[model samples]
Target: MSRQMEKTPAFLTVVLYVLGFSLLMEWIKPLSQLTETGNFNVFIVFIGMAFFLYAVKAPRWIGIILKGVFILFSIHSLYFGESFFQLTWVIKLCEHVWQNTGLLFSDKLDSLSNEFRSLLFFVLLWLITYLLRYWMLVKRNMLLFFIMTVIYVCILDTFTRYDGSKAIVHSMAIGLILLGILFFQKIKEEGPFLSFPAHWVKWLIPFSIFVSAVLVFGYEMPKSKAILPDPGPFINSILASDRLNGPRGLEGLDMGLRENDTRLGGPFIGDNQVVFEAKVDSDQYWKVETKDTYTGKGWTSEDSKGNSFYTTGEMIWKLEEQGKDTSYGGQKSAFLIYQHPMPYLAYPYGIQSISSGLPNNFVLNDQTEKITPYESDTTHPTIVQYGINYVVPEYQKKELESTTAEGSKNEEDPKYLELPKSLPARVKKLAAQITKGDKNWYDKAVDIESYLQSGQFTYDKKNVAIPGKNQDYVDQFLFITKRGYCDNFSTSMVVLLRAAGVPARWVKGYAPGNYTNSTSDGTRTYQITNNDAHSWPEVWFPKDGWIPFEPTKGFFGQTIVHENVQGSLAEKEQKPLAPIQPKKPLKPQKDLLDNGSNAKIKAPSQSNMQKISSFVKNHKTSMIISVIFFAIVCLFLFLYRKKWMPFILIWLYRKKSGTETFAKAYLLLLKQLDQYGIKRKENQTLREYAVYVDSYFETGTMMMLTKQYEKYLYKGAEDLGDWKEYSELWENLIRKTAG
Candidate 1:
């Protein structure tokens, strides 16, 4: 075979790289919501493609240096901006990195900010483009490229739940087209392999026919329920037994908030895994857990009253004073557990009775009104599949407003009014300030709730920063940030209310999920997912018990039944709080002489170039210094190129330990030779290249290097002693060949 190998045009390589990357981006678009920005991705792809092409032709050392500088600049622009020039920014960046290092494998990943997510996407795209360029241009490994492409496609398919089969088909088509291009390039570069002869075009027709048949057959395949495997007794047995202990609460009679056992943190986005389907009579907040004690950080609940259960044959549990009475407005509903398996049953505000396959040993926490099984029975576990008869309270707002805290003391625990000793005084001050005019506790509560709901604060999910170690969450949220999710708003409102002598406790549960299809029996099913996890404040009234209040904007809490109370309250001569506006300066008095004088006024309008020139003129000295600094830097780089180039290359591309290290060193040597007009042919093996080089230059070093490389690559040798030595040998070869 001829020593010279046919070379693909640089432009053609760039085209293929861009095309492949675009296809891959299309496939991965479904992986994250952040990737939906087509313009951003296109911009990044363009920049990346340009860099890759530039790096391919430029000196390896220069390329590495440029890439480093570019990366630093891009990161600074994206994350720090002008702050990057300040020493404080570096310190803060380090602190942030140190604090969040553990989050890579932690649940806190769910609460990552969109900015951080975007940064992560940027890094991911950078790595992908770098690898593509390396594999296509440097390694020329088509097989590796194919494997990576397939893995990427599989990842997209696995992680993403596409709306329709069309997305899958589209991704598949892209994959096929990309693969075709890859194969075509491979055949052109390395020639046809054994299975496919030089006349591979002859097999194309049959292959196309087979692929079409397979696609048709797959699409036409029956998709009936019968096609699914039956979840027989074995599956049920496994599910019941400890052997198949899936996620806690999935199998049934599990109780207690397993996830919310401690303090709540920053807002988190949740998975769309449907926990249950409930058919309720009214749209209400599904109460799962209630916290009585707020430790400033989070909430904790007191112990249950007692393990009280009826020995009656029927699977029924009843609460005290919560009996079958029309006065309580009793209503029945059923819940079908779709995924989650929790111990506590979800019900409306007042759950009177529960009946289903649930264990009769269900105990009720009177303080929190949360129900939990008395004991765990492995044999007959209580799955979430149960029916509940709950009582919905109907309270007249007028009566609630008039009701004093005299009799409510018996119902309202002192803990509800408890605030952290370190709680900022400004919080209480702000609360008192807001409710200064309100006479009754109900009015005060309404004022506080209204103030929170007013356009004073913003609800932010991803941007909600976690409270510092010693900082109070509510204080920071109210006075400083004024931006947060439900927990922030609700907790702040609760604290403020408590500060204002209004008894309120934090409540945790799920929001009324989206209403799905209705059953044949006229019951509407609501699909409750993990994302429905919510928290609000419950204020205590004399007879109304604990009434839920939604301070979080956009959420509806306990339906405020207004019976002449809302209108009466609105009509009460309560002046609306004037928004704090900036104080304007007093206008200057007009002078009679000025008015009499003919003074012409002209509006100043500057072009873009004029603005630029003005800016430069204002900073002329700084500009001159900057120009001098730039010239100095350019001169320094040119003079010290020999000294710094190799160091930069080694820092950028050196591998610590592996056969790959030697391989990379060899590739660098080849690139150096290419620059010196002694290019290694595409098809030339290491031994052949060594022989050719030794013959051409009368050097024995290439032969020795070739033998070591062969041992490392083919013979599975691990002790490829000190890669620096290989680098030194390559440097020596380049120096000798330069003559």
Candidate 2:
């Protein structure tokens, strides 16, 4: 606290300030949660580093202490990395890279073998090593330089709204450069780099930086952007919630889908969405009807709009008690979060009752059990609830067992028997040919599914040459050309059956998602993808209500039996998966969000995130090795500082002292040089060195010494200056040789 202590240089004060600021900035905005603002905070890291560099540079005495701090912080930063999840999320990123990379990038994604996480640790190690060596000798003195840079960058990135603090930490390199400029003057022969003119040599680092930035940013952005599809469509949909469905709370998101037609107009891409996740209780083939009759590419519903049976308080439970539940079934209450308005909520087949989550204005036709979204204005995140009776076979079997065969409901409806005007004769003949003896409706539907899928048809997304592109897609799908995907197959079958007087309606929804092992919970989870999109049909049975009969062979037929498929399809068709994988299984952690509605049970929670991360930090051997390697490098430099002076000379010549080489030589040259005022051109040869030496000295004495220098030392190594003693001798030789 004395005057002497206070006068211990501004650098030390700066370094302390830098440390305080780094801690303060870290404290003010702890890099914990990675929300949008937090992610932008990463940009401020540069400014924090700058402050740290300034503080370290502010004091030249605590080189060892500062180095230790840097190492400690770097290690700590790595452990606290996920806290900065805006930057890196190793596990999540890895899984995504593993799953979708092949889909986004071409051979680049496929060719790279998936390496384990340990390889990532090696990468981190290499990065730290490179950063250390790179900044080791950078000249960074003018604090103004960094301050100006930080201000400019903050202003520029403000448009990104990433947060200005990011600019602060990133610009810390200015501090490092200033420190190197002020203190770390020693350098060495970088390469044949000495052969280049000094101006060109000085530009090397900046030039390399420019080249690297161009290749990485300019070229990379365009290429990577081209590889990925625009997320604009999906993003816009999320933003358009206000116009799509009026004020449905988030919970009603799931139940409003079937009511989508009545939705308020907005930019909505419906077909591409994964609307419903249908998983049946029994493994029996789950079917949905999407087409009652086929026009061209789409199907029309043959069922008429019956009386509105959906009174707000009328429970479906009361009716199912009187009527029959269709399939072998059991159920739990359906809890749907309807993000936006849609039309129908498909309960797993044999839904005994509808208790909650249906729309307020929805008019559910009594006979069809259909709910329709009738309004036009919109909002989002509608949360709805549904409590359906399980209607297990234990109770429903009596109804199904005693029921008579399903007579054709289509007989009463003219719309069901109406075929598209453009129906082909051959298709009609083929349909009649196939129906030769199959009077039973189930047998008839099965016959059609088999005939279409039995190598006679193929799945193709490409446009097919169907006659009458606007009408009767069935005739084209049947006899003329059978190569079609699910839409075509189901369309053809549904229309054909309806034309033959069997009641059917077009059903639009995703096929059952493939089951996967749950991570948090040990229950079965389904991985639904947009690829499972399809349109199928449901036919009305006499007392049974409805049954799903997918007429498409490529999709529905192949997915009918588990034994008939492999991998994901097998799991989807055959049975719910037995849980296998556990996320972070090593860390005993349980999610508190298990709301019991899912039927999944989560593992128990144990260590906090920080505690679990100790695995990397506690690697004693690696830490020891890093410390030893760093210390060993320092030791080698200490031992060889003298021998390496020549390399150091080359390195230092580019700094402020490089321009004023006389600073070091001035003191040592005393015993050697009689004259004081003298200088040398950076490009001067030995002869030129001697001549420039005569410029500021008494001409004759210095001139004579310079003349001899061309004769004695013109060849190669003589121009090099190593020890301060050698520099003094060179200066004296110039003076005395000239004198």
lDDT of each: 0.60, 0.43
Candidate 2 overall lDDT versus native: 0.43
- Alpha carbon lDDT of residue 466, candidate 2? 34
Tens-digit per-residue lDDT, 491-521, candidate 1? 8888988898888888877888889877565
Per-model TM-score versus the true fold: 0.51, 0.38
Q: Choose the strongest candidate by lDDT.
A: 1
Over 4 Å off in model 1, which ranges? 1-130, 139-258, 261-274, 292-327, 330-341, 357-360, 363-369, 376-382, 402-436, 448-489, 499-501, 514-533, 552-555, 559-739
Q: Which ten residues in a row have the lowest lDDT in candidate 2?
A: 261-270
Instruction: Assess the local accuracy of residue 528 in candidate 2 as a C-alpha lDDT between 0 and 100.
Output: 35
lDDT of 2 by residue, 561-601 (tens): 11221333213343422222213222111352355565343
C-alpha RMSD between model 1 and the true structure: 25.0
Clash count for each candidate, listed in order shown: 11, 88
